[model samples]
Target: MALSVREQIADNSRIDILSAAARCFMDRGYAAASIDEVARSLGATKGRIYHHFPSKADLFAAVFRHGMDLNYEAVRPFIDLPGSALPRWRRMAMSHVLLMIDTKPFQRAVWIGVEMHLRGATTPEQRSVFNELIEYRHNYGMLFRNTLLQGREEGVFRFDDLSITNQLMFMTLNSPIFWYTPRVGETRSDVEGVAKKVVEYALGGLSKRREEGV
Candidate 1:
């Protein structure tokens, strides 16, 4: 269902707070991030943040959810496309990598949120929210996993371990967030070109060789 007008405004304000908070977390560690800092980054006051989120952890959780939602929305279109699973999977992977490059702040927040979880920085309440986001991330991962399984069934891809291979594929796709920077003259097409090349490299590892004629 569509959001009502008031709900839409509230969501927009919430996203504004989340973006500011994400930048704060991205610049400093999440544990070091403070609501005051996020407010300053947004040129707003702490009350503005508190108006939306009750705590820093809640704001962080919102950022994590926002980042995950962006990923899901970006690649969700290609997940169920008809035709060979390999091609559909490639498009999804490419779209994901492109989003990681384009949406650096939110994607970085995602990595930082994972780091926070690993370091035991979250309270029980925050952990609850994080766990829910984790489930969403798992659902997103399952789309690729299912596609990989289908490709394997068709003899289009070769992998020894399904679970490990799925994780490896995502790791490879997510790695660009660590080192990628947009060039001075680069366009979205240029970024997609690079993303496509990266996807091809990863897919090539799993695909059967044309010469083998599977």
Candidate 2:
């Protein structure tokens, strides 16, 4: 259904707030991030953010959730595709790599949120929100875990331990965020080419057949 004008405006503001907040967290660590900083970045007042979120933790949580949603949006279609899981997994990997590059700030916020959780830097309330995100992340991981199991059953991929292999796959796929930056004149094709290389490298580490032929 189409959004009404009021709802559209509200949604737009929410997205703008999330984008600005993501950058705020990226520019300053979460411990140092504030709604005022986010509002200043948006050239608005803290009241503008409070209209949508009650606290900095909630705003940060919303940003993290939005980032996860972007990843799901990027790869869910490929996950639902018919036929072999192995090939679909490659597409999923490529889709995720592209998202990491395209949405680096949001993705970086994701990593920062994880760090906050690990350091126990968040309050009880923040921890509550982070826990929900943790569950959401687990659910997302399960999607890929199912695909890996399918590929293994079909003898399409080889791995000794499912959990270790899954973690390794993600470390490789998510590593681009640590080092990638868009070239001065980069195009969609250029990004895709980089994503393709990352996926191929990931596959090569996990399965010989993928690098050799698939």
Candidate 3:
């Protein structure tokens, strides 16, 4: 039921290694980031990194998987909430935006992993895990897709092409990752404010107009 002391230390070491590797991969693309660089960033020898991860590709894939795991953990509660589809969708979308802004580097790594698959196999040994990641992404998208479809059926949303609208929403949500830099005095409230605005703007595109008092 509990991790032994040795296991705990090993777990912490793995996290440290992954965190350093993630920042390295995020700062530079996965193709350019090397194990040595990650080791240097951690102020440890390459052997330290190698003890945890066998190769650069393994480290990169772990970072990508961590990002996906965070994403799932963030939105699962909201998605499981009861009541109307639109409200649940809004909560899930808002949570997603907040997760993205708060975990910018990890989120960036997630996108980089997505793009990496397009350029062909860079990590042949980890291709199976990469494919699993793709399936995980599709399942994640389906959370929104299915909710949006239900919202459309309920007259809460209007869109002709489900896939296109979903893509548009994702693009809008992910845009902040590209340009968002936290301000000096910004608080969690400020971040949430921005996230709220983003959710409203994105959902506005799909919302159906209603007559006054109707």
Candidate 4:
């Protein structure tokens, strides 16, 4: 199938707008961001943005969804690899942390959205998109849950309650968002090291104690 120039231009324009919207939303929280500013950032006109997204809310949702999609894609490969749960968890943590550092705009947009949702920013479409994103987020949680179950079955992990343990593991893995910062001297490798340490601490608690006890 051959593509037309007009179609390619349209697709590129949409991507540019979304990228610009992401940056603008990150720099100036979504509530404070204006479509005009995003359009100007993209060297675009408001009409171009409207051509792609009918409303400001719609554009925000699109940017948020795009970020979620990127997260899903980044973590998807490691979810089901053949390994102990701990190793997989470590990989997921490092992957996510590095992603937060590398994909600044996406990460910032996500954090902004999180704050907004916590503050009751709920319209019908926004609510629907948020619910869907929450469900999508469950994919990562499910990986942790299944990994815990697997480790338990293998007698490697001993937890009293699978549900609570899974939740706790996810909570620990997600801490990077709260505390991580890439300063002038900090490197991605540094973040990865921290992620590994976090995974180690979490897995250590979950692992069964040896009978001989050190």
**Highest lDDT: which candidate?**
2
**Which has the better TM-score: candidate 2, or candidate 3?**
2
Residue-by-residue lDDT tens digits, candidate 1, 159-181:
99988888788888888888888
For candidate 4, what is the lDDT?
0.75
lDDT of 4 by residue, 81-180 (tens): 8977667766775676566556668667876776777787878667877777667666656656676777777777888887788768756655665566
lDDT of each: 0.85, 0.88, 0.86, 0.75
Model 3 per-residue lDDT tens digits across residues 61-153: 788888888889999988767778889998899989998898788889888988878776555766788898878887888888778888889
Top TM-score prediction, candidate number:
2
Residue 80, candidate 1: Cα error in Å is 1.6
The candidate 2 region of ten consecutive residues with least summed lDDT is 205-214
Model 3 is weakest, by summed lDDT over 10 consecutive residues, at 205-214
Instruction: Score candidate 3 by lDDT.
Output: 0.86
Alpha carbon deviation, residue 75, candidate 3 (Å): 0.6
Model 4 clashes, total count? 0
lDDT tens string, model 2, 1-214?
A: 9999999999999999999999898889787999999999999999999999998888989999999999999888887888888889988998899899888888899999888788888888677788889788768877898788888788777888988998888888998888998899999898899889899888876775634664
Regarding TM-score, does 1 or 4 come out ahead?
A: 1
Q: Model 1 clash pairs?
A: none
How does each model score on TM-score? 0.90, 0.93, 0.92, 0.76
TM-score of 2: 0.93
